[model samples]
Target: MLNIRCPYCEEDRPEIEFRNAGEAHIARPDEPDRVDDRQWADFLYTRDNPKGWHAERWRHVHGCGRFFNAVRHSVDDRILLTYKAGEPKPDIERMLREREA
Candidate 1:
C-alpha cells in the first residue's frame, strides 16, 4: 500500500484516501480564444507520460479535500515528496545524486 502525505493536512495517509490527478504545472494560455484549435486541444488533452521521475497533482478527496503536488518515481511507483500547490518544487534528483556521491 502506498502512503501519501498531504501538505495541507501535514500528515501521511493511505493512498486510498487520495486520487491521482495526473501531471501538474501546466500553464494555461493567456488568450484561450485566440489559440489555434490544435493548440487548444493539446492543452486540454496532452499530458506528460514519463518513464522516470515525474511531478503530479493529487487530490486528498477522502481527507482534506484539497489538491497538492507530489513527485513520484514512475517505474517504482514510489512517492519522493509532496508539497503545497504554490510551493517551489524540490530538486529530488540533485539530492539523490548527492546522496549517491
Candidate 2:
C-alpha cells in the first residue's frame, strides 16, 4: 500500500487517508471583474498534465483533515516530499539533482 506523509500531521499514513486536491499554486485573478470570460474559464478549467515531476495539492482527509502540497512523480507515482500549504514552492530542479546524486 502506498503511504503518504502528511506535512501537517508529520507522519506517513496510508494513501487511502488522503485525497489528491489537484494542481498546486494556482492563483486567482486579482481583479476578477476585469478578466474576460475566456480568461475566467481558463483559470477554472485549465491544468497541466506533465509526465514527470509535478507539484500538486493533497488533503489528509482521514487524518489531520488539512491540506498540503507535494512534489510527486506523475509517471512512477512517487511522492518526493510534502509541505504545508501556503509555503513557497520548492525548487524542483535542485531537488531532482540532489536526488540523483
Evaluated with lDDT, which candidate comes out highest? 2
| Candidate 1, 9-96: lDDT as tens digits | 9999999999999888887899999999999999999998999889999999999899999999899988888999977777878967
Query: What are the TM-scores, per candidate, against the unseen true structure?
Result: 0.89, 0.95
lDDT of candidate 2?
Answer: 0.94
**RMSD after CA superposition, every candidate:** 1.5, 0.9
Model 2 alpha-carbon miss at residue 7, Å: 0.6
Per-residue C-alpha lDDT of model 2 across residues 4-54, encoded as one tens digit per residue:
999888898999999999999999999999999999998999999999999
- Candidate whose TM-score is highest: 2
lDDT of 1: 0.91
Q: Which ten contiguous residues of candidate 1 have the minimum total lDDT?
A: 86-95
**Shift in Å, residue 13, candidate 1:** 0.5
